[model samples]
Target: MTEVFFYHLQSQPLEAALPTLVERSLERGWRAVVQMSSPERLSALDAHFWTFRDDSFLPHAPASEKGAADQPVLLTTDEQNLNGAAIRFLIDGALLPADSANYQRIVLMFDGNDDDAAAAARDQWKVAKAAGHTVTYWQQDPAGRWQQKA
Candidate 1:
């Protein structure tokens, strides 16, 4: 079953969400893919994953030459380096769907205020629901309280 996960960036710290998401994926033995805008944020996430010796991290490098379809795709917005991993596009509160064949669960991490990020997340949530995939939303209150709603 395909699963879509969304994190609403409310009052919660992004750091607090990573471990929870990581644990959930590990518990289910799922290949997780995360899409984000800031390279610094991605780097922080990579650092968080280091705590789990069993996890592997792939940072999107971005693709070179816009028309070159044969090259490896990277998610980085930096047009100069397009030779990384596949780019995961985010829209609002939705997450772009990954290749369902390779991944069982997808966790999208993004700032709630980012318009594109939120839209992508919402789109992914709809897609997952239509596909009968489980969907979960995690958000934080202004007080730094974490809340997970499905």
Candidate 2:
């Protein structure tokens, strides 16, 4: 069975979540992929040795040098390339499909402020539930702790 984990990035930046997810995936020995829409943010991840491109799929490797095999693969889209090998794609709150078979699990991470984001999160939750996939919605407090409110 595939598992999907969704996290909202309203309280914290996606940068903060990346390392945590990578660490968790490594610990659990699970194959994981991450996708995002921000070029600047993607560049930042590239500096940290995360892979970014469209033609290739790279796994997350914390110890690899720049352009090494042991790096997290990241893909940047500009309307031309909308999707990559991402099992889960972290998108803006307003845009995401509620029902998707792209992967076994789908995670929705967003801030609580945006109304569209909230709506999408709820919709994704409903879809995942209906499809029998694991759905998780988390909110971060001022103290920087992720509390699973939903």
Q: Specify the poorest-scoring 10-residue window by lDDT in model 2.
A: 77-86
- Where does model 1 exceed 4 Å of error? 27-31, 35-44, 47-95, 142-145, 148-150
Which candidate wins on TM-score? Answer: 2
CA lDDT for candidate 1: 0.50
Compose the digit string of candidate 2's lDDT tens values, residues 29-126. Answer: 44444445566655566565333334432354222234432333333422221223334445554233443555555455666677877777778677
Model 2: lDDT to the true structure: 0.52
TM-score of each: 0.50, 0.59
Error of 1 at 66 (Å): 27
lDDT of 2 at 137: 65
Q: Whose lDDT is greatest here?
A: 2
How many pairs collide in each candidate, listed in order?
Answer: 23, 12
